[model samples]
Target: MASERAAAAGVLRRPRLVIFDFDGVIADSETIALEELAAEMTARGAETSYEQARALFLGMSTARHMAYISEKSGRPCAPDFPDVWHGRLFSRYSTELVAVTGVHRTLNLLDRLGIDYCIASGGSVERIRFALDCLGLASRFEGRAFSAEMVARGKPAPDLFLHAAAARSTSPHECLVVEDAPSGVMAAVAAEMPCAAFLGGSHLDPIRTRHRETLIQAGATACVGDHAELQVMIEAR
Candidate 1:
């Protein structure tokens, strides 16, 4: 009985909206992004492996990525670094990227369930659109995408998630965040939103268990392994 009450205290019951993180949650773009980013940094003399890149910059913007590269290389990245990355990444995205394995099907299910969802991502609006369009998800999220570029502070701060929730007319406690980055999970927690730490990606395989535990410790309400597991949690909630 005591244990049951402890579990009950953590339940959200029903949230009015779902906020998805872009790169790793809805789109399988993290691995692709990290690979290309690592190569880009290497060309600038800041060589890094995929694992290192992911560790150093999982939920940062392109500007931040370039800054890190510049810092590491001890030379500033070109003024056109953002444009350069956008062109390169988008070009490859057209032929190489896809949505998270079962996300389209999961979105369809959410549609059927009458649940409202929008994206709140650290990626720029243009980059988010490119990935979603590549995955044929543009129409579903047409006017509903929120970018960290719109806010003064990004992930690990509650600004972006709170902005997203406010734009959707939902309060923080009335939302659930599906996040694949520790910083994002922390943001959700700070916003008072229940977080579902997602471990459903090629990029997350190596540190999946460690990440899951870390997120739970960071105040995630749950840790889900795949879209199917997320769907189950969604339906139950």
Candidate 2:
């Protein structure tokens, strides 16, 4: 319905800059990452499922994810866990990662409109860059990627989003955040930015309804089912 309205209006409130979350919003890597995490935790004796892993760490940073796993599993994560996990994840990413469907088209729309855009994610900069490279999007986002490691706090806190806006020389209200996780929506809201919750990630296929409701409840101004709808929302004047 909102997509229809945006299409009819021919103009949504265009933002000065668009801030995207890297994993689920730009790259379809969340399912793979979560599946790996689930297996890792299960092997460590946590006995977690992919869904459970998603619910717990979908938008969390590496440190936070490890902490959550340690707490929930009642097992101390080995000091090298992050390194080991990242090694495995990156291996999978190299072979399986791809851009979210329609993302290139959405980016093209933004480029044609003269809108600036950047990425701000809960992932490490190395991982983010690696993913972009795997998806062949590294050049597009070359110097525009921001990671949680760049800020003292990550998602669900305004720090990272605010940092991204500041880095882009855009005011909070002038930025639009595209996110697929509730924590990310909350962070965008906390940063005083308009947020569009993305429901197009493959990881959301089985839990779209609940995820949509959760994102809305967390303060998303809009929920887009795909980058096509997102393009309409961004193109509306």
Candidate 3:
């Protein structure tokens, strides 16, 4: 079909590796994340919504989130809030941050195809490990996961993804970044890596509206919502 050919053209001609973002892409944790953040914000008299939280807080570090909310609400978030919030969020995340739909199967497919891949996330190294361990995916990624905190700068900076690519021993141009946030897309662009934005979080529409062209203009060859379609694209490449 014409559509099939078009889809094929959208994929990389030959990719040496793939890198994935965590929070909204491979884990079903955004809704619960918003709830937790809202709870924390309520104590500070700030409002929250899945959309607002995703747009402003998700993919950001706790310190960044605290600073963001502080600026938004004009109130100082409790200094201990980060530790407490992290504890509460991790407890819930441990219980609820299951693998996203089809993620496990897709990872397996990639493994079967002998494709090199890694998780490049904005979360801390410990947090990334916790989620991977909870999902029993730790074994699949030995020396392959790199946290943003490990780099000089986080998302929108190109450090994390670039580090992951370096660990995989691949050129930036040959690596494909699978992301779910505008920041991640920006990071990919800054790294000069090809990217694909997967619309899966609460801010999906807004992120699409705001960054669809930015992503393409930033060097994303394609944007898609379905993981199956992404799998097909990768396989074709």
Candidate 4:
């Protein structure tokens, strides 16, 4: 680690690994997921908008989503909430999910740079795998994708990101996380990892300015709105 003076004096170490958050960063699925969640919540009498749902659960597990809904609505979510929500989600995903715009190009750039990357998401392993496979990204990640379920805690807590870095043979400080949510960015910060906050998700494009500031305030070292900006940051001197 370099002192602030040295860091400002052109001393720095390039990160050894890139950790990606999947739902919003890679799969182009967060908006759709939030839409479906809002619909489900409305149907179950919770009645929230997509915006509200996204704000409430951007970087949480399905269990947490349900808990939040229950607490907010003053009614218990159904015991089958997880199964039903996931069923609808996977159904829509089968027909609607796509890779985030420019993901392939960014990945190709990383490949050319010989930079190894992996997915570490608050999403469940099953959901992560399903979306990656749907987006034709499974082979690229192979054994490297990790889930919140694999760790003791999820985002805004460092456990999942820390576990991912450890499993991938990178120390926390040696990894750079590209995240779409404030919670994920905070988790990276807590893990002592440098963060490159991403804001290209369809759900976020509408609120880029606000989200960008929030991420920076949460300790992102860089904020990139799309893969092009990401490429620039990754290759910058």
Please, what is the TM-score per model?
0.91, 0.93, 0.85, 0.91
Local accuracy of candidate 3 as per-residue lDDT tens digits, 1-237: 337334634656557788988877787666776678778876676777666776676566666777777876888877887666667779987777777777877788788887788889877787778778888888888788888778888888888888888888998998888887677888988999888776655435455556555555555667766577677777777
> Candidate order by lDDT, highest to lowest?
2, 1, 4, 3
Candidate 2 per-residue lDDT, tens place, 8-117, comes to: 33523689999999889899999989888788877766788887889988888988877866887788877777677788899999889988899999999999999999
**Per-residue lDDT of candidate 4, residues 1-237 (tens digit):** 124223322322466888999988888999888988888888877888998988878878777877877987899988887678878899989999998899998889888888889998888788888888888888999999999999888899999889988998888878889998889989998999888878888888778888878877888777777887777667654
Please estimate how well model 2 matches the true structure, expressed as its whole-model Cα lDDT. 0.87
TM-score of 3: 0.85
| Model 1 spans with C-alpha error above 4 angstroms | 1-10
Candidates ranked, most accurate by TM-score first: 2, 1, 4, 3
Report every candidate's CA lDDT.
0.83, 0.87, 0.75, 0.83
**Mind giving the per-residue lDDT tens digits that candidate 1 earns over 1-237?**
224323533475556799999988898999888888888788787888988889877777666787887888999888777777778888899998987888987788788888889999989888998888888889999889999899998888999999998898898888989998888888998898888888888798888878777777778777778888777777776
Runs in model 3 lying further than 4 Å from the true structure: 1-11, 73-77, 200-219
Q: Against the true structure, whose lDDT is highest?
A: 2
How far does residue 173 in candidate 3 sit from its true spot (Å)? 0.7
Off by over 4 Å in 4: 1-13
RMSD of each: 3.1, 2.2, 3.1, 4.0
